[model samples]
Target: MTPPRLRPLAAALALLAAAAGVLAAPAPAAAQSAADVAVAREIFIEGSEFAKQGNWDQARERYERSLAIKRAPITLYSLGVAQQQTGLLVEALESFRAFLVEPSAPATKEYEPLARQAVQDLERRVAALEIRLSPGNVAGLAVKLDGVTVPVAALDRPRMINPGTHVVTASARGYREVRRSVSAAPGSRAILVLNLERDGVARPAAGPRAVAPRGLPAGEVAAAEPAAGNLVPIALLVGGLTTFAAGVAVGLVGVVNASDAPTRDGDAADAARAQALAGDLVAGAGLAAAGAGALVLLLGRPPESAPRAPAPRAAVSPLGLTVRF
Candidate 1:
């Protein structure tokens, strides 16, 4: 029983038979096995018969099986037609698009307009989904659209679907079944979210990760120790203070010697002049040590918080003693 809509294209059956014959010819390269081609031929014939009988489901199945054995381009169009009759608008659109994209004989080119028209019509009947999931590992969770199990790989992607009231379901081992009903509109993007919760309780959506003002990760934030300064500053201060004290004592002795020196004693006066000169040089060294110690103390500080920076690298000063981060 030929469908009323397909009767006008009865001439296409003869063309398809001719195309199948040409396809069956042995190729010099990229040829399929004789057994596979024979099987495809048998299945294709069966699909055509089923199609004529108006058993679109059986016809679609036969065409699909035939294409699986060997990609017969003719079956793509027939499959599209069968899918259209069976209310598989989305699948039909895909089939017609594939038919147009595939390289077929010039004889098949005449059907290009028909394929394009089928695609246009199906596009208006098909519904699309924009899937969403809350942040976290959703691995092993199963999803279904109207009792048909959705592939895990298809999650979180925009996909074409039949326009109808669908019961979306999500399930996992320890999670309670999450079910939501949605009325899908034709040629529109509808959001579908399957948020599975633990056992009987609902889980709240996860928020953004918290970060410390210090550049440490959440785990390391509390564990990170305060900056401990190097021993250079302490050493500088100790040496400077000791040197200054010794210089002060030496200078006092030199001052007393210089003040006590007699004008008549040339040797004593010469000795006093040497002591005063040594005292002045020692006091100058003490002043230099004190200045260096003060500089180090004043310049060195614990690093400030860098919220977004990489753990700052340690840098040694040009003097090679001070450490700056």
Candidate 2:
């Protein structure tokens, strides 16, 4: 008796309703673990009590616990409210963001303005700092800012720093520690670059001079003297002299033997041996001279004269030219 089109439409509506019912069914006994549900209930009760007592910090902690257990929108909304009341604008903004992710979230119109205001206030309180590494070298080093150690994984990552002057230090084994003072303003950023180098052994003391905080100026580059315990030059000198003397002595013996020989064949062999010995002596003498020169250069003294001149006086002419005779 019913029309064909109406019957088909009714059947389709029934099927869709069945599917919705299945999807919206409560959690099954096997699906809802008793321990998890208990934890969630406990967190909700504790958070409610804390909020009723006007203890915002305790309320925030309980709400965070509830979030960790189960991310319910109502719990998140309450947490955001508590965080905002406690002046934790950043935390409130994050909480509201989490609540908005739920499809069945309630009170969209009421919470939207609050979340936006929290975000705006948080932005004003935070500062961005640019950290640059000199020479783009960041190997085997650790960087720290304001007593908080930054992870090596976060190197070159721009950070949101709190407003104030902060102590920045870069340190590595086998290298000098580089440190500097940096200041950051609200909603502003400061750039800090660090360069470090390997530290060498200190040279022996030079003559007395004015000591600056970071050692002497460039013009006061004092010549570094070799330590008395450096045995390399002495060893080279001894070895070269011994070889030279032995070669000369052997050459003299070969020459004497060649002159005394009666047979021309034996004389030729002795002369050849003498020539080889003289060549070795010459090579050893060259090495000895090089070793001595290196020692002298290493132990040399720098000139003590000051080379600075007084500044020239300006002329009072229209062209501002000074006349030099």
Question: Model 2, residue 240: what's the lDDT?
Answer: 67
lDDT per residue, candidate 1, 72-101, as tens digits? 567787788888888888888888899899
lDDT for position 229 in model 1: 43
TM-score of each: 0.52, 0.43
Pull out the clashing pairs in model 2. none
Q: What is the C-alpha RMSD of each candidate to the true structure, in Å?
A: 20.0, 25.0
Clashes (N, CA, C under 3 Å) per candidate: 0, 0
Error of 1 at 194 (Å): 3.5
Best by TM-score: 1
- The deviation in Å at residue 161 for candidate 1 is 0.6
lDDT (CA) for every model shown?
Answer: 0.69, 0.59
Cα misplacement distance, residue 236 of candidate 2 (Å):
42
Per-residue CA lDDT of model 2 for 164-184, tens digit only, reads: 777887777666677788888
